[model samples]
Target chain A: MEFVQNFPFICIILSMFSAIVSFILPGKAAKYLHIGMVTAVLVLSAGTLAYVAGTGESYTFMMGQFPAPWGNEIRVGVLEALMAVIFCIIMLLSVFGGIAHVEREIQRSRKNLFYILLDLLLASLLALIYTNDLFTAYVFIEINTIAACGLIIVKKEARTYVSAIRYMVMSLVGSGLFLIGLSLLYGITGHLLMTPAKEALEKIIAQGTYHVPLVVIMVLVVIGLGIKSGMYLFHTWIPDTYGYTTPTCSAILSSLVSKSYIFLMIKIFFRVVGFDSIISSHLVNIIFVLGLIGMIMGSVAAIKENDIRRMTAFSSVAQIGYIYMGIGLGTTAGVVAALFHIIVHGITKSQLFISIAGLSDVSDGKQDFHSLKGAGFRCKIAGAAYTAASLSMVGMPFFSGFVSKYLFASSAMTAGSGRLIAAWIVLGVSTILNTVYFMRTVITIYTPVDEEMRKVHGISPSKTEQAAMAAMILLNVVVGVASTPIIRALESGLAMFG
Target chain B: MDVIINMLRNHYQDIAAVFLFVIGMTNLLLQQNLIKKIIGLDIMDSAIYLFLASKGYIAGRTAPIVVDGITDVERYINPIPAGLVLTGIVVSVSVSALMMALTICLYREYHTLNLDEIMMKIRKEED
Candidate 1:
């Protein structure tokens, strides 16, 4: 029982251990070993969630047997635990999806490296979520970026290489800016501890000796993180990167990578900078405007895209906009909305990508709308899942997306940001536009094909693939129906802001 | 001119930092070659290091030291930014290595080091 309390860190260690073992194992053995490790992680995560929920208390473990203000502290508060739980659920689904897709799509020679980098990616994301130290967080972010780039290049496509390069360049610039911000912060405060840093910043601000250098540093930090999170105007790298990667990798990158950055943004803006102070300045308004532009531009671009993967990539850009919009509103509900949207959107987008992967399998590399004609009649389960998930993206009632959008809009109204409200209305129109494009694709999937074409395109997934698709579909359904309890849990976790 | 020189001497490190930054930005903007752009990034990064190092400088002060029977110790530069720069240097070197590998891959694929030519090839294939 006590061991279960330390399961989060244990899970991370186990992932890294499995990654090392996978390198030495043979191809067939490595695949099974990877599956076994992912399953163990899933069980461990479930048990940890149950234990945490039962105790209803936070726990902190300082790594290397050191105390705070000098040592690394891993806090498993309600928010951290909840996010961990979500991460585990998504990772589990991704594991199954990756297993099935990798077997068919990816070559056998690269299987070992694929599994190793995948596990490393998961471990780094977990580390990023759990660690309290800012410098340690930066290290984990770099690790995740490196592993993601490795995954991108596994396909060996020229476009994939180009996208990975762009991603790497942009990330370097972003991290450099983040370092500058951290340096300035340390200069002003003489400490790296977030609590002390915030106190020092507040004191400096209250003294009314506004320093231009400090302001410039803050702006640089915001822009840096904004680029990392794929916020508009700095989001040029996203569509190409996500569009070129394999569907399974795309799912992880879209669901996990951007959300991690958003989490950091929340930590910085709300906790470190203090939302009150940010709002007093014009930073909050700037974030709001950026979010609005992203929402409009991303949706419009998705509407015009012909490639299925590129369309989904653009959709992610728009979804990130919603998150920023929520945070930009600067109200309690808005914060809650942002957090909730991160979870819901993570599930929805991952499922969509997984479904696309399944569709590619059934359609034999035919991913465009025209070639997808009559796919629904062939792949019934995946078709139904895609339809439901797409409906959720359109903000249909009884789905997780609806609750998030409603909360976000209501929060903007309460915040008295009339411009934000107008932005939300425009976003609402964009959502409809999203529905129109997705429905067009869906209707084409159901449209009848000729006999010759049917015979040529007659392909179906194996039993394992069906099971994986079913698992993801069930998760989507369960999350949609059982969102209220999750929302309640999150509200309790976010009580600190109030 | 004498007054300006005196001011520059008083802030020699700042002037050096500004010069390095301008050089880096120029190289990054004007250089068509990828490796040169990366070198420019390093130059820009070094400028920041200079700035941080300069912030810790004080005139007429020796290195802060404590030894046996040595009670009077002069002020020394701040050690924090030096430590930070060490980490930053490691990060930059690793990034450059990755970029160099990526450049090799790009050359292998497109058979050219020219950015415009590589992009043209990609677009042609896409169309």
Candidate 2:
């Protein structure tokens, strides 16, 4: 029982230690070490999750034997543990999918640095997910930023450098706003821990005091995390950043990295600022409207994109909108729908990127629509995976994406009449928009081409890549087929969130 | 009207922090020079740190360090925000360094420090 509580720190320290060890070891050795560490992290995460689920208890472990409100702490509940498990599994898969690409694209010396950055990234993300202290989350957010930059610029193309800089600017602005918001919360609550902060906030809300500061915090945190999550109007950096980065980096960026930020946003919504505060401040409504707009706008942009990777990157923006829309619904069902979509989108998006990697090879490494023509026939595995992923993204029946969309729309009906209609319209149009871009890609890739152009350019994926792709597709199917159980788990998890 | 004036008088420090924040964000959005934008980012970070440090200040309090005999809780201004600001400052420093590294890279390739010019060059190259 006690050992389960220790798992969070053990996993975090293990990753950080591996990062340092990677620095001293050779690149090939570091790669092997990475493989071993991820395996261990997976075990620790799964065990922690099992313990939390079985016991149905949340535990807080204080650092250095210091009590709460004075010393640092890491808190893990069923939800946080579930997030950690999903993160480690997806991270390991992303790295596995990208290992060959990393070797092919990155210089041998820099390969070690790439793995080191990925290791540090995994550590910071786990810390970000588990940390109870707001200040700790802020520090880890910065580490996440710097590590993401390292991942983005690992290939060292001039375009990646430019894209990385733009991303840094966007990220700095986001974190800067988030820091000020945290400072405000501190100023009001006199506590940095989530539970204590919520207690203080609840007192103020009860007394109807500090109404202005509470609203300020709500607004700032939403905008801050929104920018980080690539919501519309703040998502200018996504296409350039995601499209220019290597397939592995792109997969990691789209899947776990942004998803974790969004997860934190959901946590703050549920934990720190109570649901009443969220509604009273009109923040949730604002999020709802902005989400509706972003949903359509992102899909519109994606439909206009010519590059295959860029199109998928833009689709990520729309997918994020769906998650926020669920949150905007401001119901328990809505929140669970959002969380379910996070897992579903994380898997499906990564599958798309990994398959695109194989597809990119067959097209002479060019990732434009014209280049991808007929390439699907050449690489059967990636094509099959790509077809499955596209179907999921379009919310076809019997896929995970369809389930989330169904949940999101049904949850929207719980809102008032006007908001319901708005949510329905946006969701309907965006799904169609998603189909437009994804289906076009699917069609173009499968279209038959001349024999001269059909000269095989890419070899079959190695074993690791194949395994990663298969796992992604299989997970999507499982999530869809067994959604009832997962949804029940999520419902219970959210019920205990506060 | 009187309540507004009273609130402003009491919260001048917060007001200043807000002012600096707006200035920093405006520079980030409006400036074309990459270095200035980076400076703008630092300023925004400084504004937040300033806000945090001010939040910890009390009307009359000694430093947070504990004395051998002083036991009163009110004797020390809040120490947490000071520690927090210091950490925030460190994070911003590393971010600044990364942003600078990026700027240097862009400068070498485009031979310009203006973001718009560099972007233009890249677009031209693409075309």
Candidate 3:
């Protein structure tokens, strides 16, 4: 086997090791460990992405001496490797951009703990991305949930505590349903590894056995992950959970954490359940209608939100809705579109959240629309970055969001009549709504202030933050302008999904 | 009624598990007190464990371990669900503990155990 094949397991193990080691280190040491670990993971994943894309083959490494049904495994492909690279880059940039807020918002005694949770979060996300065993994925999902809760509660405020609890309660419910679903699936298929489970399911489908139970299991898993990823009506906890946290926490949770759950769902759909069975089950129709509602309703909520941070949080619900709508299309083109949107939204949203820290710094730590007036002029770097992010999110030409939106539209054109119409109508209306709120926020921040408000003055972001913001925005534009290769890579990568 | 009776007769374990799950979920969602909510979560977890355990059990099979070198597959019950149940139990304990710790923090700040009351107080303070 090539040495690059070991990179996937090493990335997961190294992150987990760092998480454990960070608990014993000082706060500054932990921070350094975090940066070093994320950078190392990024390099490793980039190398793996290059190799996997070049070879055009996916490989699975056994966790123990046993293989197949008996052993846990990690599967690495171009898609998984590319996702790992993007996750690491976004995590590193988020940390660098929001370290100031981390210092200010988190208590001194708990800073190391914060890094520990971040390391664990990274580990669990990597595990979720690569794991070939359904049971292993479940264990890591719980770990991810716990680490995310710790990240939120480290802020030490009543609001954070409340939101953290709410987040935990909802997540626990989701995981419970997921666990039960897995249990039923295991009972029926008698395999926990995804490939074996897929084989077993295919046989069952051929024999026309246990059809009712299969449908129930599908609903359980979908609803479980949907709630966790902030799908539609189940997203009530998002604003509180995403709004009250520190900027880094908010960015990571919005961009990486939720996306990991959605990615895992997509994996289960293609690998374990089999796309044919999923389509024949007609659950995609339900997901389609719900995602359509979510697309419009989420943007409406964002428009009504008075608080700037909460508005951005609401926008995430809409973004997540778009990804699900792609999944609901139930075609390979649709899944590729969903995967592309995942990357674009991850990049654009992190930039938006991290820039908020800088913008609010100049606005006397206020995040309301009125107090944020002229924040763009005060913090020029943040203002420019936020404007770029908003433009991308609004699907302007030469921005990453435009590419994903274009992909979704083209993918929708291939669907059946009813769905094609629904997808286009929702997509068009959602884009207009996206424009309304995002452009309005941009105008609000850049609006000139009177002399009385000018006293707040420019509070330039630190060099590290400025550089991170620049890297993120550059990535956004690059992914936009040079999207053909990425989309081709995704198409080829998804071909190897099973 | 006969169909319901037939389901209850054969799949009693699954029926009970689903019942317990619904009851626990309702409690978790409807209960106002933080402790009760945590209890609800625990009950829900227990329902899953029970379901898993029942799935693994067989009427005539012995324990998974071989006695007297009887290595036949049919001699033992399925062991995967047992392992999964154990993992689920450990996870639930940790989650319940985390929830309890959060409850303690909430009580420390507000001197109340009611989630609705706490949220109301927070909104009041925010304004």
Candidate 4:
């Protein structure tokens, strides 16, 4: 019972150890091991969440014996606990949803390596979420990057290599900037721990000394993470990376990887710098404007894309922009809304990628929407799943997307004054743009075909896949319908953040 | 102006590090060859390491490891930055290796080390 205080470390080490062991196991055994590990972590994360929620308490675990100021530590509140649970659930669901394609795409021998990388990536992600020290965050960011690159090239194709190299280069640049920021901050503060750093920074700000360096640190870190997370202008690598990977890889990368970087960014914004300082420095303004651009640009790009996966990849950038916009509002409700959108978008986007694979199966692996005509009639489950996901993405009434969008818009509105009109107008335009592209793709899938074409194009999901897709769809609905309680929980969770 | 000059002179190692960082970043951004770009990556990382190590410098401080009967805290320079740089070096090595491997794969496929040429070939193939 008392051991649950150590659940954060337990979660991290469990995955790392599993990653090592999985590397030696056969692919089949590695997969089951993967499932078992994810399930165990999920159960533990749920228990932690329940404990945090019930008791309304947070836990901190100092790695080794050193105290937090001098050594590494992990702080977990309801937000961390809940994020861990959702992350594990998404990992399990996406892997399960896209397992058949994973087997089909990856070579027989290198399959276990994929799961191994997944384990390491998940471990690093948890570290990124829970770590209270800046240097630990940087180390895990590198691990996450390497593991993500490993995931991209696991299928071993010419396009994959190109995309992987681009991903590698861009990510290195981002982390380099991030490291520079940390170095500057550490130089000034002499502390890498979040709480102490904040104290140091607040004192620095209070004295109005070294104002320029503080702004540089803020901008550098924000831009570094912005690039890593595919915030508008820095998203050039995303389509190539997401589009070339297997659907499972795409699902994982799209749903988890960028999302985690953004989570860490939000963490730094709220916990380390404090929102008041952020608003004063006007860093959120830059995030806000770029987010608006990203929303419009991403949708326009998605509209022009021919390949289904590439289109969905672009849509993901736009969804990230939506989350960024929420953050830019610079209010507590805004952060909560953005976090809510993260969960909603994560589930919906992964489902769309998985469904894209299903759609491609019907068309004999051709990815162009024109080639996917009458796909809806042939693959009923994939068609329906895609429809549900697209509608939710487009913010149809009573779906998950609408709920988050509603929350986001209202929160943005609550930030009344000069930015209010711009927020509403941009939200309206992006929503309309989102509807245009998403509905175009949906209509293409549902377009009619002649009988001769229809008979030859049948593609059915296996029972497991059918169930997985259904579960994803159900998950979206559940999140939408259960927003009241979730929001309440998230509010309290966010209140405990600092 | 003289005081500012003195301050800059006092922190010349950091100025040099910043200069190296800019050169490395320009190489990374502007170089055509993938191999050159990788060297640029190494240089950039080294620049950061130099900056960090210099930041940890305290005049006349000894090594962080304690020896027999040496007890003053200020006698040793901060070791944390060195440790951090060590980790950064290892990560940079692996990343450069990965990038090199990717470059090899790319060269084998397209017979080019140039980004523009590779882009042309890839785009032509796509078309």
- Candidate closest to the true structure, highest TM-score: 3
Q: Compared with the true structure, what per-residue lDDT tens digits does model 2 show for residues A331-390?
A: 778889889999989989998999999888877888888888998887877888899999
Cα distance off (Å), candidate 2, residue A362 = 1.0
**Fnat values, candidates in order:** 0.29, 0.88, 0.68, 0.62
Model 1: what TM-score? 0.91
Candidate 4's residue-wise lDDT over A1-498, tens digit each?
377777778889999999999878999999999899989999988888888898897777877868767877898899998899989988998898888878888888988998999999999999998989999999999999999999999888888988898888789889999999999999999899998898988898889899898889999999889989999988999999999888888999999999999999988887788888888898889888888888889999999999999999999999999999989988998899999999899999999999888888888778998888888777878888899999999888767998998998889877876667877888899889988988888898889888765653534556677788889889988887878887888889889886
DockQ for each model? 0.43, 0.84, 0.82, 0.76
On TM-score, who's better, 3 or 4?
Answer: 3
Per-model C-alpha lDDT, please?
Answer: 0.76, 0.87, 0.92, 0.88
Best by lDDT: 3
Pairs with backbone N, CA or C atoms under 3 Å apart (clashes), candidate 2: none
Chain A: TM-score in each candidate? 0.93, 0.98, 0.98, 0.98
Between candidates 2 and 3, the DockQ winner: 2
Give one digit per residue, the lDDT tens place, for model 3 in A42-104.
999999999998888999998766878898889999889989999998999999999877887
Find the 10 residues in a row with the least total lDDT in model 2 chain A: A453-462
The digit string of per-residue lDDT tens for model 2 on B1-127 reads 9999998999888898999998998887678898999999988888898888888888889786776788788788877788888898889899999989999988888899988888898899989
lDDT of 4 by residue, B59-127 (tens): 899887877788888788888988889988998999899889889998998899998898888899989
Worst 10 residues of 3 chain B by lDDT: B62-71
lDDT of 1 by residue, A140-250 (tens): 777787888887777888888888877876776677667667666776766565555677778988886656756766687788788887998888889888887777788
Model 4 residue A168 lDDT score: 83
Q: Give the TM-score of each candidate.
A: 0.91, 0.97, 0.98, 0.98
Model 1, B1-127: lDDT tens digits are: 9999999878788788768866875765456677786787788778867776666556676445654555554545445566667766776677778778988998899898666777789999978
